[model samples]
Target: MAAMKSTLSDAARQVAANALQNTLVDLLGLSLIGKQIHWNVVGSRFRSVHLQLDELVTEVREAADQVAERAATLGVPPDGCPATIASAIALPVPQADWVRDDEAIEIVTEALHIAATRLRKRIEATENSDPVTQDLLISVTAELEKQHWMFASGHAAHAQ
Candidate 1:
């Protein structure tokens, strides 16, 4: 499909593109982290936590695609390079080694929270200049919030 021509001014498109790029980076990082946790999580809750991390990984990857495509529509090249993502991501990198279920839960929850918080700012950043971008970010933010809640709830239950 042909990319949609953006109606936003160059300056506005630049701003929106930056916001989208930032979101894309964070989402990519989150997806990788989710996968890392999925692959390495151990403990009595292994099966459930592993499954949940897979779901989170899928969701974040989808969101990253949407954000990157949106940026492309605005004539911005979306950067998904490892170095770019590593440097631009708002969340801390979890340990590379195997992690227990509780540690995995904390790591993923923190990353999701960071993504959601940044996405909220992006939503506001695009509001006046690019309503469509704002709406897209709003949708992403909503999903991240829901995912965060799901993880948080599970973490609470795991703690008890």
Candidate 2:
């Protein structure tokens, strides 16, 4: 089959492809982490954290889809395979089979913050190379930041 063509110049295409691929991996990893926490979280705050994890997983999955599609649109093959994500994901790993609700909050909050920070770098990398991809990264970063704030804030509320 003929390779798909992209409107972007070689350098620009490379930049956007790299950014999108990395972002996709992180998003997919975040979704997995959220689901893990949702299933294993315990304590009196379990119900609330579980529900929030579901919402976070939904948002992360949606963002991953968007990032992967954007890569395809740019004529880059998006690799979201488990192996790729496992190798590329920079997010924290769960230490145990079960986590306290507050601990889950801390873990997810830190993960989101880390993902958002990496996204900001991707946003900058794509700024001059491909503003369209940069825009998508910016939006994804915003949502991640929002989720991070929510998790952090909720944890604080519980502490008070």
Candidate 3:
């Protein structure tokens, strides 16, 4: 068997940086989605959902910062203004107005689930080339997925 390569190159690092920039874009996307869900949630679970919204956004915002910093570490500036995020994100169409509590939660759950899945793949890619980065993406993905399931099931229960 051939011996493993010594390490990634500067060009490889730049490629990693580009991927990191993409991750940062998703981070901004996810954070904004969380904030939107929190802002628009309604229904019988008002207090619970609304209260949890703040926590969701708080965590997502932190994750966004972490991803941005990771991009910085890789020498790529994270380009994530609201417009950029809106342009880049490929999530479902969100309602401009507040949705029924269940709809709001469901939309958010799906979006988070998608983000988590995407992040997991990005994490794996960065794992070999950049361990420090892989760690943050892994942690963020796990948390988002857990939250996704929680909200998804809750939304479903409300419908039943």
lDDT of each: 0.88, 0.93, 0.74
In candidate 3 the C-alpha lDDT for residue 75 amounts to: 59
Q: State the displacement of the C-alpha of residue 79, model 2, in Å, after optimal TM-score superposition.
A: 0.6
For residues 1-160, could you state the per-residue lDDT of candidate 1 as single tens digits? 2266677787898889889989989899999899888888899899999999888888889988999988888878899999998777779777889899988889888888988998888888888889999998999999899999999999998789
Among the numbered candidates, top lDDT falls to: 2
Where does candidate 3 stray beyond 4 Å? 1-8
After TM-score superposition, what is the CA distance of residue 148 in candidate 1 from its true location, in Å? 0.5
Cα RMSD (angstroms) for every candidate in the order listed:
2.3, 1.2, 5.6
Candidate 3 lDDT, tens digit per residue, 52-156?
Answer: 767777877888788787666565667778788788887764667886677778777877877787887888787777777778778888878888877887778
Candidate rank order under lDDT: 2, 1, 3
Deviation of model 3 at 3, angstroms: 33
Per-model TM-score on C-alpha atoms: 0.94, 0.97, 0.85
Q: Which stretch of 10 consecutive residues in model 3 shows the poorest summed lDDT?
A: 1-10
> Candidate 3's error at 71, in angstroms?
1.1
